[model samples]
Target chain A: MTHLVSIENVDMRYGGASGTLAVAGLTFKVDKGEFAAVVGPSGCGKSTLMRLVTGLHIPQAGHVIVAGQHVTEPVSIVGMAFQNPSMLPWRTTLDNILLPLEIVERHRKRLRAHKAEYVEKAEHLLDVVGLKGFGSKYPWQLSGGMQQRANLCRALIHEPQLLMLDEPFGALDAFTREELWCVIRDLHAAQDVTIVLVTHDLREAVFLADKVLVMSARPGRVLREHRVPFARPRDLEITYDKAFNDVVHQLHGEIASARRAA
Target chain B: MSAVIEDIQKSEPARPLIARIDWVRASPWLYTIALFAIWEASVRFFDLPYTVLPAPSRIFAAFYQYWSPIWKNSLQTLYTTTLGFLMAVVGGLALGLFIGWSKVIYAGLYPLMIGFNAVPKVAVVPILVIWFGIGAIPAMLTAFLISFFPIVVNVATGLATIEPETEDVLRALGARKLDIMLKVGIPRSMPYFFGSLKVAITLAFVGSVVSETVASNYGLGNLMSSAQSQFNVPLVFAGLLALAVEGIVMYSIMAWVERRMTGWAHRSTMSH
Candidate 1:
């Protein structure tokens, strides 16, 4: 697989020079169509690394290259979902899903003429996420899990090359989080989109990602990278397997040691 | 299957229609009726002169006695207030959008805005009269000047307080500043705009009434002032009642609009 994203020896500092160093010499690469999860202790600058890749912030040193272009500004070929669903309160679920299409260039111009077609596409996505018939309801009318599902649909609606999730399932309960993991796994397989998930959940990382990258605590750097040996169409039952628990336990130990060295 | 059937059987019957109704929704009107009844009973028992404190019955009588003039004047007040409020809405939205579009503008103008708002609008009414002469223009100008501040402040706050997460989401999508404002800022500020409308409408009424009492030839304010000078306390109370009704009507309309437009914001689950 070809590399879709490459971050090289990046240094990021918050506030100013005399301020905190958030990331130090962070280097990693994600292959095209790869599902990569970055797992770290809390406050390990995992989110800052996401910012670097998305081009929301330029690193003080080194380069962030996505899809063979050096990112100097916010990249348009990326989609993002956060821990907070952050749906616009004035829009219904379907409208919220249609937001990126309304803003992105190619879709914005055609949206007026093809609104019915777009609406059908949005409803189809909702159906895939178990939100069928919820298109008419306002964000407030839906449950939290439903809103997040809608949010995911919104991110994917524009069909970008890369999808970035920043602790997307962190705010959900255990059962809902597990259910969404399957949803995301299915989406990744169907869409053939490269995904970079910033999360702290080891079980989630082990279950969903093709490769798990561990980051050290603050002034974070890539601590280790472990390629999951599990095959595709991973079942929830696989999580109970001894091999799955072993990989999780190994990463758990690495995270603990990283915290001690902090 | 038995457990499921037993669970269905154990469910309580539906509540009675009246019992299911929300009493809190009707509490306002009920409270109004109770207060009016108490006022009528107290004045009748005390046998007070109408000049001192008119009973609800005598106030209603006065209201009926001069119904035509009262209605005309009430319509006049409503028209002027609405016109002034419309002007405020336009000017406030533009200025608020400008102020909120950037941090520099917000910081530079916020203090000045507060100082301007601090100057009592009632004091400005006389100056407006002197410039434009005693009429509806001065009343309208007063309403605009007094009511526009809340709208500007509220709208600016709404724009300024766009969640950092929300901004990040849009920005990462390569959305331009104008795109963010058009797509998100204006729509997000709507709740705040409607909230400020409720506040500003009430302030608009105060502005109009103050100007009318001091300068205008029509409106319930002028009617009340004249009635007070003549010691027609019942007529004055009738004017007060008219103003109260108008204020309540405007406020309720704005509140209804707010709920209609921004219900998702306040009612949406916060768990995520």
Candidate 2:
């Protein structure tokens, strides 16, 4: 199967830290409709990976090919959600969710004509995220979880074929994080879009990923990859199963080794 | 936080008998009535000479007596101030956006702004008179000078304060530079913009008053100056009161605009 995204020997380095490398010799590809997670310790360039995939950062060394095009600058085809959610404080919930559409083409052209339809779309997404009747409310009025849900909905609103999540649910409580994981899972399943989730949570990886790619500690490199064998339409209960624990333990061991190697 | 407002509200009625407690709660009418009562009583109680101070009743009588000329003068001042203030808004918004959006220009012009602003706006009215001459021009420029800085400062702050992550999000969404400016920068900075507008309005009023004090043959400020020169103290007091009333009316109009523009803020006040 043709991969939706192909990473060819990628290397990334931010100009800030003197002679420090964020990621090196990293290579991975996500197949069409696949859900992949990159797990690592703190400061392991997990965010850098997201930037690389989203075309926000150009690789110093190999190529990043997404949807059959080589990445040079930021791309519109990818939808992204950051850990902070970072919704605009001034805009209403619906307005904030429609932020991408306001800037993106085709939608911008069609916006004046199909404004009501778009509003209906945003409202439906809000409803699906359990935020019905909050379309008029600003970001500050909502709880952290609600904002994060809105963030996810915003990322998915344009229905980009590739979704990039950089620790999107890291700030939420355990319950809220799990709740968002289900929300994301349902979204990915319902749409069959490819997702690249960069997370530190092994349980999160095990719970939602089709394949989890483990990266080393600083100067992150893809050290190993594991295919999670759980059936489609994953539930919170499956995480308690022995197979889940086995995979988690194995991934935990790999992370421990990666940390020791550092 | 919510409890604080509720507690104050609940406590408002409990101790009712102590000198018309509910009267204070009815702040709108109570404020004006109390002010006029104290004003009239103070003049009467001290038996201060009428030339030094006039009773509120006398001022009211003077207000009616000079209704046409006084109203015309007031209108002229209002027109000049409003003109100057609008120019300031446009200039402030344009120059402010320019200076604010660019770090280099901010560095280039910020110090100059500081220096110019340091010189009291009124101090420059004589120069404005030299440049624009007498009548509306000088008065309008004075108002413009008075009010311009706050808007520029506030608008610049508003324009420049876009969150880094938001900029990043827009970039990732492939938004053009213009798109970022119009979509993210402008609307995001509205609250700060309104804040500046309020400050500018007051400054504009100050401008008109100062300008009229110097050059204008018309305007409420000119009327006040004439009253002061003629030593008609009650008329002077009446002009001052008229200015106060005008200021309140102007403030209320702007405040209403603020309310309409930012209705989402009503959610906060709704709990009250």
Fnat of every candidate, listed in order: 0.76, 0.61
| Shift in Å, residue B147, candidate 2 | 1.2
Q: Which pairs clash in the backbone of model 2?
A: none
lDDT by residue (tens digit), candidate 2, B159-219: 7888776777778888887888888777766766776788888889998888898888989
Query: Where does candidate 2 stray beyond 4 Å?
Result: A15-21, A86-98, A111-144, A216-218, A246-262, B1-25, B39-69, B100-103, B265-272
Q: Candidate 2, residues A165-216: lDDT per residue as tens digits? A: 8888888899988888898898888786899998889999989999999999
Candidate 1 displacement at residue B64 in angstroms: 3.1
Residue A130 error for model 1, in Å? 3.7
Q: What is residue A153's positional error in candidate 2, in angstroms?
A: 3.0
Predicted candidate 1 versus true structure: per-residue lDDT over A198-236, tens digit per residue? 998999999999999999999999999999999999999
**TM-score of predicted structure 1, chain A:** 0.98
lDDT of 1 by residue, B172-219 (tens): 888898989988999889888989999999999999989999898999
Question: In model 2 chain A, which range of ten residues has the least summed lDDT?
Answer: A11-20
